[model samples]
Target: MTTNSKYNFKWEDLGDIRLGRPNLGTNTHVAVYRLMQYTMRDVLEKQLGPDKTNLFFIDAGFKAGVEFCKNILDCTLGFDDFGANLADKLLEFGIGVLRFEKADLEKMSFLLTVGEDLDCSGLPYSGVAFCDYDEGFIAGIMHQYTNLNFEVKEIDCWGTGDRTCRFAVELAKS
Candidate 1:
């Protein structure tokens, strides 16, 4: 896919939320967020089909994750500290509760879980994992942190009858 020369996203594009919504602030109902997400998915699926639509969401989420890491996270810390900071930031932003279930620093692989995920925490079982965006999001964050490509896959999700979203992250085989 070719990059859009006309418009490229940057962290500054988010603008000053505090100035924009003085009273309401940055918080919004989860239902409102889910409405936008689900509606966008529906429209994209209709136009592009499921696989391509999933790719688009993953790509968009990757971009968002890269920018979020650059703008919101401290990248200079050690791995454990960085993970802690990431978890804290996720919670602070009301995104989710992040935890590392397993980590192999030698292999650069991890099993991470997100509880109350912004994407699919309470979703009913649909016999499929529905956190493609989150998969890319984690990969993007790891890319920024380690300066290496990663393959991130969601093996379990609320959509798959799991209470939390679980991802398997590993270095991308080049």
Candidate 2:
């Protein structure tokens, strides 16, 4: 399948989309989290339908997180650059240059919920949010993306790996 059709995403006139940084913590992987959010937009929008809902499965624990992040980083930035600290890269990139940290749970989990909501059968262009924590990041991105805000909650999962946690920013969409 074509990338556009496979991911269920479509180009919008919103210009460039960026995610706000989350409060830092040892477990907070902000860059990776943000990357997932934006990428999900593309995935669902392209693979499903412009107005279709989405579902996102997230890694529940730490060990799985490491592997998830590694795989995602390698896929997006390559194995060598994957070793590069994402926080440092974000700080270096400065404002307007968003990064997704692999450990940022609130952001990451929030995205998963929203993605699932989007994947669900519901109102077109409208969606729900579910997460392992509060929906702070979901609201943050909604405000950041469409000037809207939303609520979120956590969803339990049978902790698994084999998923990538790579961070991405909308460079440009064709």
Candidate 3:
């Protein structure tokens, strides 16, 4: 990775799970993960404005999604296969439940939904939408799979009282 690279997510950053206690392999309660994420976000929001903090979270999530896709997912698979694999991986990793609400392959536009989203499925409503990170995550995954840039935005979030998080993804304009 270059010293000035925007995203320095090397695959090796994720170490072997087998070496991590041998009994507790990537298994943690959702509350624990949320605690860390929310706390970090809180600090960031306090230091930086909400917009900047959200950008940071999105960038982090984009990096994570790219690295995760490269390391864990098979990029060679077709749309259906890739989606199925992603669904299985999300379930296996206790991330969330992924569903496709709309897909237009020709236009490269999609509406994706995640039930029990890791970001804000159960958060108390604050009228403001959360899950900017998830926007970047979904974008990263789509970029990796299609080798095309995408713009992902959260349309509905649990923070806004939605049962599921909904994202609208479209190809980036040239």
Candidate 4:
């Protein structure tokens, strides 16, 4: 699928991620959601590992994954590059899950977890395949979005059982 096409959205517990012409002006909210997915699948998988089964834990994982990717994207690439500019790359290349959390809705602050499964699949599961899936998604994201060429010097993660991880994004000087 093309970037425009691949740029799909799945509002978990919402629907089948169908996309129609923007009934609303910019669909910024949806755009952000798509970016979150890209972050989780691309960046987090490398740091955390891939394995997508155990849908139950995926929700929590998405939170962690998205935050981690965002900090790096924001501090290193900036919102435009990380968001709009990166959209095509993200859709085309794909990155592993980065893991993220909503630090603040008003300020749009986020945190990335360091340890523990972001997906919170809870140790011991139905085959390690699930773990691989999450990791795989993250890998895909990396393949897709690394063009920005940003290095995440350090990441601090926290939380237990689907909690937000506090994070800091260190950038590489150009």
TM-score of each: 0.96, 0.19, 0.92, 0.24
Worst 10 residues of 3 by lDDT: 1-10
Stretches of candidate 2 off by over 4 Å are: 1-28, 54-174
lDDT of 1: 0.92
Per-prediction tally of clashes = 0, 32, 0, 51
Count clashing pairs, candidate 2: 32
Tens digit of per-residue lDDT, candidate 3, span 1-174: 456758565886556767966998767788898899999999999999798999998888887788778878999998989999998988788778999999999999998899998878899988878998888888888888888999998989988888999999999887
Superior by TM-score: candidate 1 or candidate 4: 1
- The residue ranges of model 4 lying beyond 4 angstroms of the native Cα positions read 1-7, 10-72, 75-114, 125-129, 147-174
- Backbone clash pairs for candidate 3 read none
Ranking by TM-score: 1, 3, 4, 2
What lDDT tens digits, residue by residue, belong to model 1 across residues 1-174? 236777888777778999999999999999998899899999999999999999998898888888889998999999999999999999999989999999999999999999999999989889988888898888899999999999999999999999989999999999
- Report the candidate with higher TM-score, 2 versus 3: 3
Q: Model 4: per-residue lDDT, tens digit, 1-174?
A: 335755543334232333444454323444465456546666766656654323323444444335445433343654435544333433332332234443332333334433333332233333222332233333223323443322221232221223322343322246
- Our tally of clashes for model 1 stands at 0
Tens digits of per-residue lDDT for model 2, 1-174: 245645532233222344332443233344555567557666866787643423333221222233323332233543235434433332343311223333332442222311112112122222233232212322333233322233333332212221221222221222
* Candidate 1 structure, TM-score to reference: 0.96
RMSD each, Å: 2.6, 16.7, 2.5, 13.0
- Among all candidates shown, the one with the greatest lDDT: 1
Task: Note the Cα lDDT for every prediction shown.
Answer: 0.92, 0.32, 0.87, 0.37
TM-score of 3: 0.92
RMSD of 3: 2.5
